[model samples]
Target: MIKFDKVTKRYPGGHEALRSVTFEIAKGELVYITGHSGAGKSTLLKLIAAIERPTTGTVLLNNQNIGTLRRAALPYIRRNFGMIFQDHKLLYDRSAFDNVALPLAIDGVAGREAGKRVRAALDKVGLLNREKAMPIALSGGEQQRLAIARAIVSRPAVLVADEPTGNLDSNYAHDIMALFRSFNEVGVTVLVATHDAGNAEGRLLHLDHGALTEGVPA
Candidate 1:
């Protein structure tokens, strides 16, 4: 679970990215963060991931204040989160299998175990047949699925996606959302940040000028 208590983030130039934002995401819930450009959606996600610290207030992940966690503890803390981004962030030089296996490798998992998990993740994304395909050879949707495979290969507890469907056509976007819904059904907490209102599902949280708005879906 993630909780933000009166969080505020201010840059050095006197610009505030988020102002007194407060919300809680319960475990096993799927929530969408919706807002326009520069509305602080990304900043909120970053705070939960501990990529950025709040200038005021607290960001709690499973009851621990992540903002006060030591740098040495960050990687361990982040191990619980699977982060996806709009660009897919695939390694063009690597095949889909290798890309998905990277996280396990980084964690020093044995080759056999890593291979099993990698295949399982790819299977979940319906990309097992393309395991050997290079990223550039795949279509946009496949690449995004490959990214999802990579993100989940580690079996993280929380899945955080930023504009995950932004680059795809409506069909692919819906397909991706369905995948996230499936994951949520199986107990993976899912949080998505997107500008597209149609992408909102489950609990919807809206932001305007860095502030949580009354438009939040009931």
Candidate 2:
């Protein structure tokens, strides 16, 4: 589980991305962070994933204060999270198999074991047949799915997606949401930062001007 207590993040430029935000997300829950552009959704995700530390207050991951962690311990703490960006940060030149294999490769997982997980992840995203396909050869939805596959290839306890459906059509968006729900059903804690919930079946926390405008901590 993750918990934030009076957290605030201010950039060096004096821009406050999050101000006094507090929320608790339980294990195995699917949660959506909804808001307009510049609503601090991405910042919140980054903080939760420990990509960025809080400027003030505390961010606790299972009662461990993330902001106070030592530099060497950061990577170990981050292993609990799998992050999906809005840009679908896939390698343009790498094959689909290689793209999904990056995380396992970084973790020094052996080739045989990594290959099995990579294939399983691709199959989960309905791209098993496209293992050899390049990013340019796939559709927009396919690329997003590929990005998702890469994120989940490590099978982290928490899944954080930023605007996972922002660029897809309604049908594609719905399919992506269903995919997320499927993961949640099997007990992966999923947190999707989206502007539109679009019939999302989960707890929704809305952000406004860097503050928690709605939704209580679950």
122-173 per-residue lDDT for model 1 (tens digits)? 9999999999999999999999999999889999899999999888999999
In model 2, how large is the Cα lDDT of residue 143? 96
lDDT of every predicted structure (CA atoms): 0.89, 0.93
Summing lDDT over every window of 10 consecutive residues in candidate 1, give the lowest-scoring window. 209-218
Candidate 1: segments with Cα more than 4 A from true spot: 215-218
| Candidate 2 clash figure, as a count | 0
Top of the candidates by TM-score:
2
For candidate 2, the per-residue lDDT at 73 reads 89
TM-score of each: 0.95, 0.97
Task: State in Å the error of residue 200, model 1.
Answer: 3.3
